[model samples]
Target: MLDQTILSILKEQDQQLFDLVLREETRQHEQIRLIPSENYASPAVKAALATSFTNKYGEGYPGRRYYQGQVNTDALELMVIERAKALFGYPHANVQALSGAPANLGVYTAFLKPFEGKIMAMRLDHGGHLTHGSPVSVTGQWFEILSYGCNENDVLDYEEIRRQALEFKPDVLVCGYTAYPRLIDFEKFGEIAREVGAISLADVSHIAGLIAGGAHPSPWPHMDVVTFTTHKTLRGPRAAIILAKDADMMDRIDKAVFPGLQGGPHFNTIAAIGVALGEAASPAFKDYSHQVVANAKKLGEELKVRGHHVVSGGTENHLLLLDVRKSHKLPGKRVAVALEEVGIVLNFNTVPNASDRQKPLFPDGIRLGTPSITTRGMKETDMVRLASLIDRTINNLKTGKISEGESAWKDDDEAVTIAAAVRELATSFPTFAW
Candidate 1:
């Protein structure tokens, strides 16, 4: 939350933007946000974002900056880099990539030529990110892409992955995801990349906080290069990090990020990243991370018990993908919208194609997680309650109490009752309890 003084400044300078921020804050306080990629940065992290460091521009690495007034910026960034390396157990790191996409591009530029290099990655529809060579991104347009996907049951088929790796011999083996809800076998990915002589890069944007808190396994010791965003599970600022196993790899990625992709770093964000790293290093954060997974698993279990079609059967991480088409006989967008009206917020997504042929838009699946709610100090019992609300919302939709389209479920007695229940549950905790 912004301090009163900062809110006053915002209100004075830009009333419209301030109002939007206020409305959003109110909405967050009233809704159960389940978007896996979204979380509330701690007050310290948010405060760091509003610092005077935002005024400076440090154009290069610590010692060799292109700007003159970089003493403070350099120290802050260097400290953040060291924190990242230490926390992630890596030898070298570049904390300058603007965000995850540019971070991955930095890695690509470090090793691959524009048209000649091949990147082997998980298919986008199967949980891969855009920067991992989805056809819509620059990563796919310039470079050759070989994609692997889950099996008939929406599970990763590692044997098929190995077969593809042997067949393609890609320059980079990419193993990370946006929506896959199971634990990644980083060791197996490492073996495949090593056997194929490809550089291994893991993007842990979704679970960097979990890895930091030891809820999930680290990608290092298995990956040659690793990239992650600070804002996601890490509960930091909106920036990204690239870690390399050795100096040679580090040098290439650093040069690629500095002189190749990005310009001056966001110093405020770097400072906040340091703050978040310090916070994440605490014992409480470890407990919060474990609870995040517990909540997700319990949520999946509850949903499954209610006869929901949970993708991959269940989750081992902080997220669950549901085929709403199977359960409610409704499109995921309809369910997502209807649920949001009831104060439970999540996103519609593409389930693995095994169950249905769904595209990115109007997909039949919904993706949600427990990170934000867990950060708000929610637990398994709360997840059970949420599942019940979700079931009620779906049932309401079926009976025409919940409206479709870009409309809220207002003007109905039952809808109002469910919404009141949601608000009661949502307002019970502070925005960032953990």
Candidate 2:
């Protein structure tokens, strides 16, 4: 458990901030958190964030530091790097990136000159993340981007992706995704990148834990560069790590992360990441990873049986996109709001082939996953019950029982009934502390 001494001190110094923190903690304990990218860090990982290392400024790599007081910082960073490399089987690891976007930007800086190279990546709506090639991101702003999309059935068309890579001959070919539920074919991606004379980069930010625990295939020995966030599924602090197979590429990435992109590394977060990597390398975490997938499969199956349109028919991993507009005649945003009123948390997402008539602010799909719930120790049977609750909530919304708008649902009788039942169920399966 976390040491409550600091929290007690904070409560005495700033009652208002302490109250807000308590309320947020209560909300987390009471809600069914289905967000795919979210998880509860273990007590050790949390404690590492509050350590004395946070006060130091570690500007460079171990043994090559620009600062004087880095003896302890260097030891912590080297442990983190070695743990990450051992877990992922990578030859080199850089643990200084603040988050996923910076890690990706570092890769670009190491390999390609600004405006002198091109990138081929998956389309955003089809499952790619914003950093991949979205026009709104710095990556798209600085480089020429060619994007490929999934087929009508919501599966990656590798043949078409290969064709695009061959035609464009981009400087880099990137794979992996944010909302994709199926296993990625990293071998094919590497083959295409090789044929086109482009570097292959796999952004396995969402599935890093699964890879570490042997629940999913790894991109190693095939991909030249890989990036992942420690917080999502990995259940660590909010930081990112980059790994590479070649020594030259590793040196380039290290320089890019230090002087090219960011300054001093956050030693506190790096220590927390080391704690998470240690946990991930354990046998227990492997069981947790397998159970996460099993719970997701059961939840998707139950939702499909209830007549919901699960994108791509079902999920093979941690998340599934529920197309509420197609089956329930309700906007995804509307359904998401109603679920939240009942203490079921998820986000509205854009499904493949979403029509322009459906506004971007209110897309046609809701993305739900089993990571957080699985972390709470819920299993397949629990997933069935939760799916039933979700079905009842949506049915009430489709009818006139729960009001159509977001705010009006709070006062409706059916919504209140559902919320009470949700609270009861949530209390039964208390979240784990460590």
Candidate 3:
């Protein structure tokens, strides 16, 4: 929660903006917030972001910075780097990246020659991220991309992946994903990369906190370089960190992030990340991580009981993909909008085997996760209730009780009923000061 005094000051400075912020705060407090990539930052992390360090322009690494008055900034940056390395058990870490995408780009910049390098990555429709060589991204336009996808059963086929890697002979073999609900075999990826003479990069952007808390397996021994956003499951400010297994790769990554990519680092965000890393190292966060996965599993089970088609049957991680088109007989886009009306906010996503007719914007599945709700202290019991709420809302949509409109379905009686229930649940597990 923001300080009331600060709110007062902001209200005086710009009343309209302050009112909007208040509205957004109310919305956050009211909604279920099932988005996997979202989480409520702790008060300590939020305080760190509001520090005077944001005013600094530390343009280089700690010891050899390019700007004056970098002594404090250097110390802060070094603290963040050390904390990240210690937390993730990496030999080296760069905490200067603006976000996950740039951190990944830094890896490409560090090792690959422009317009010549080849990358083999998971297909986007199969749970991979855009930076993993989606044609719209710079990584795709600049490099030759060979994409692999999950098998018909919606799980990674390691043998097929290895075969593709060998045939493609890519410069880099990327693993990790955005919406994958199964445990990744980082060792298999490493073996395949080794056999094909490729660098193995694990973009654990979505699972860094789970890895830190031992809820998920670490990509340490097998991954050459790992990149992740600090904000997602890590519950920090919007920043990123890149970790490398060895000194040589670390040197190249640092050079790529600094002189080759971004200018000055966001020191305030780095400080917040350091705080988050400290929190993640605590036993309580480990318990929280475990609970996050448990809640997801329960949610998936309950959804399955409601006859929803959960991708891969259930989830090993914090996220689950629901085949809305199959389960509810409604497009994902429609269900997502309907859920939003009922205060259960999530996103439309493409399923592993989505037909060509199902466009990106109107995908066949909905992606949900327990991160934010878990952060709010919701657990397995709450998940069962949530699943019921979702089932009822979709049923209402299907029965034409909640009519769709150009705007959100706010005026519908059933949506209002579900929204009330959602508000009650959310208020019971308040995010304030957490």
* TM-scores, each model vs. reference: 0.96, 0.96, 0.96
TM value for model 3: 0.96
Summarize candidate 1's per-residue lDDT along 342-390 as a digit string, tens digits: 8999998888873455778878889998889999999899998899988
> What would the per-residue lDDT of candidate 2 be over residues 154-268, giving only the tens digit for each residue?
9888998888888999999999888988988889998999999999999999989889988889998889999999998898999999999899999999999999999999999
Report clash pairs, candidate 1. Answer: none
Q: Which stretches of candidate 1 lie over 4 Å from their true place?
A: 354-357, 399-411
> How far is 215's C-alpha from truth in model 3 (Å)?
0.4
Query: Rank by lDDT, descending?
Result: 3, 1, 2
lDDT of each: 0.89, 0.89, 0.90
Count clashing residue pairs in model 3: 0
Poorest stretch of ten by lDDT in candidate 2 = 399-408
